[model samples]
Target: MGNAIELYDWNVYAIFAPFFAAQFFNLKHPVSALLATYAVFAVAFVMRPIGGFLFGWLADRHGRRMSMLLSVGLASAGSLLIGLAPTYSSVGLTASVVLVLARLIQGLAYGGEIASSHTYIAEVAPAPRRGLWSSIICISSMSALLVATLLGATLSTVLAKQQMVGWGWRVPFVVGGVLGIVALVLRRTLSETNAYEQARTERQTGSRPSMMRGIWQNRIAGLRVIGLVVGGTVFFYTWLVAAPAYAITVKHIPAPEALWSGVIATSVMIVVLPFAGALSDRIGRRPNFVFFTLAAAALSFPLNRLIQNKAWQLTLAMTIAGVTIALVVSILPAVLAELFPTHVRAAGIGVPYSLAVALCGGTAPLLQTWLATSGRGDLFIGYSVVLLLIGTVVVLAMPETKAKPLE
Candidate 1:
């Protein structure tokens, strides 16, 4: 639930960027301002690796609950700052500076949140059902994106363009900030996982277990996570986060319509996640990943061709993309968690995973928008296919963890 709220706060910035870009940057032209907005969006990704390492160390050294508490508090503070950030008109470049600082905070928190939560779930779940349990992450994540899209659609429908630009864009940020407090409260009830407890208890009485040492010991496992995450994060952000904006900006689809289409597609994806996770448990993690890579790679250009400046077409494109995406995301956390022992699990996932995302997913929106603007959208589609194929190779190289025991 805390993950859900944190994602909502993070994704809301992407959804509302078209409306609020002019408020932060001096760029007056719509495309220019939008591009500039995406630049700041990528800036957050730059901080994610640092956040991931910092929070992962904290989680391993202290406890998952403590790490979560601090991450959520930081996220809430960031959201509130974004909600009340001064405009270009009021504070010149200071507005953009505040926006950057806010995103940096969020980047760090989200980086830690993913690694800790994934580690927590894999540790607590029964071995045979770990895949199914891991789907909760995807459910929370997709549901957050759905809610952000719904809220964006709702506001765009009710508010005038001027009003949306002036203040409506801030509503979701404020809501996210307040709800983050509730998540922090809920997270306080969490206990350390048994695996972590055991790992700590069995250690030599005199020596402090080093988080960095644990990560170093499992360096190979961390490398596997980085390979698997690169394509998954890039494709997910491209089709889910960047798709609707592409429709509205490049195809000239209406804002409300494009956003509402994203909501519907995301809703369907959420419904598919648990079933996909269960299937991975029944079969094996590799097959689901294989299917997602093959299917998403095949769908890239065909789905892009399907959108024609119509809401339903956009819906059709994203719905196919989302369902295929569900196959991978539903099991990915479990797959990554199963790679490392509990002693170094969080940091192992955090370091390499966050680095991959910062390099790929963080740049996806800007890359997609630029391709569309330059009339080279097909090139972006090709780029996605290439990444998917690389992911396929990585998935095949890794052993099946379906019945593997955590150390």
Candidate 2:
């Protein structure tokens, strides 16, 4: 539930970018305004590593529950601020500044939420079913994407352009704030993970140093976590956020149709994610990642070309892209969590993952836009392929964690 709320808030901004861009920036150039909005989106990612380290440390020293509760509270506050933000006409630069600040807080909360939640879930789940349980994190996130897309689509259908640009875009933020509170309520009932408790007890009785020192001692493991995350995060943002804008702006597709394509693609992803994760449990992470990445790299050109066709073709192409994303994202939480020891697990997972996200995922949309504008969309594909190949090599180098005990 917490993960769902986090993704919903995060994706709501992306899905509503066109509308919000017009609302907030009031720029004459549509692409420029959209880029500006995405720039703010990217800015929030800059804080992710900070959030990850701060909350990861809190989760390690204090408790996951406490960290989660605090993070959610911060996210809720940010959402409310966005819901209530004034337009540039009313507040000048203050509006954009406020929006960026609110997003920064949201990014920070989200950075910690995923790593801590996944770590907590992995610790509690039985070894054989760990993949299945861990996949729920993606399932919840995809579900949030589904909701955000649907809401964005519905609002576009029901509200006039002027109304949406005026106040309708704020509706999702208000709804997100309310749902964030509900997630907080649900989180209150969650028991502390036995793994965390055991780790805490051991620390109290043993001689473990700071999490930073422990991470330094396990630098190779930390690099492996970063390597595993790079492909998944880059592919995810590319297909989901970058593709829609690319379809609409560069390909000159209708806005409604482009959004519908995204909606269909996200729905397919939700269905396929759990199955892929389950497959990884049965087979192994390395093999699944290898197959998925190779297939994706091979198909990148064909898929992008197909998506530039008619609306139905676009939907089919996006569905295929979502399948490729599901293969990587569904298994990532479990794989990353399994790479570290319990003592520095939170910091180990959170910091490196956030770093990769900041470097790759957050910049994906902007980078793809620039590449396409420079008459080199294929370059973006090549970039994605290189990351996936790097990740494949790293995955092959690492040991499989299937059926391994969480601790």
Candidate 3:
């Protein structure tokens, strides 16, 4: 439920990127307006690491349940603010300022929610079936994207363009806010993990300091997380969000067709996600990680070119990419959770993962746009390849986590 609510809030903004750009920027040039909107979107990701560190600390010192509740509360507030925000015509620069602020809060909440929730779920699950249980987090998030895409499509089809830009975009935000409240209520009933309880009971004094000391001692684990996540984040945001926008705006594909292509691809990913995790459980995590990273590196260019062909071709290409993405995303939670002791697992995952996300995922759209506009679309492909190569190297160097306990 928490995963669903988080993805709902995150994808709502992404699905309505075009509408927001037109409504908020007041620019005559469509690409310029979209770029401006994406810039603001990237700025929100800048706050993720801070939120990760802050709430991760809270989760370690206080409790995971409390940290999750706080994250949902902040997401709810941000969604409501976005729903009620005025357009540029009515409020000038203040409207944009408010929009960015809302996104910052949303991003921060998102940063904390996934890391803490993943840690909680991984800790609670049995050792052997941990991969299967952790896969549900990604499944829930992908399901939320499916909902967002369907809602966006329905609204886009029913409302006239003017109405969509002016008011229809608010519907998703309002729905997201309500869903966040529901998630908060559901999360309140969850029991704290035994890992946290055991850690607390075992320690006599200065536990917080001990946890910090442990994190500092295992610095290599954090670096491994950064290396593993960088390529995955870049691939995800570029292929899913930025590519769709590029297809519509630059390639002149029909908006509905492009969106439907993504919708179909995401649906395929949701189905395959758990299977990939199960495969990792059987075969081992390192092999799957190495395969997907290499596949992403080799396929990035061809996939981009295929998507530029026709609608059906684009859908086919996206489906393949989606499968690769699913394989990577499904096992990551379990792998990261096993990297640290129970004392600081939340921070261990959140801080470094958030940093990698900020450095790679956050800038994906802007970098893609710049590359496309500069007549260097191949450069974007190169960038993805380089990241994947780095990730594959790190994955090979790091120890496999399939046999490890959560703590």
Per-prediction TM-score to the true structure, in the order listed: 0.98, 0.97, 0.97
Which order, best to worst by lDDT?
A: 1, 3, 2
Provide backbone clash counts, one per model. Answer: 0, 0, 0
Between candidates 1 and 3, which one is better according to lDDT?
1
* Model 3: colliding residue pairs: none
Point out the higher-scoring one by TM-score: 1 or 2: 1
| Candidate 3 lDDT trough over 10 residues, lowest sum | 202-211
RMSD for each of the candidates: 1.2, 1.4, 1.4
Candidates 2 and 3 compared: the better one by lDDT is 3
Please tell me which predicted candidate would have the highest TM-score against the true structure.
1
Give the distance in Å from residue 209's predicted Cα in candidate 2 to where it truly belongs: 1.8
lDDT score, candidate 2, position 38: 84
Off by over 4 Å in 3: 205-211
State the lDDT of candidate 3 residue by residue for 1-407, as single tens digits: 88788878876786688776877777988889888988888898988888888888888878999999999889888988999998889988889999999999988998898669889988987778777778899999888887887787778778887888889889999999988888988998999999998877766554455556767877899999999999999998887656666777777776677778888988999999999988888888898889999999999989888866477877887788889978889988898998988888998889999999988998888888878877898998899899999999999999878858755
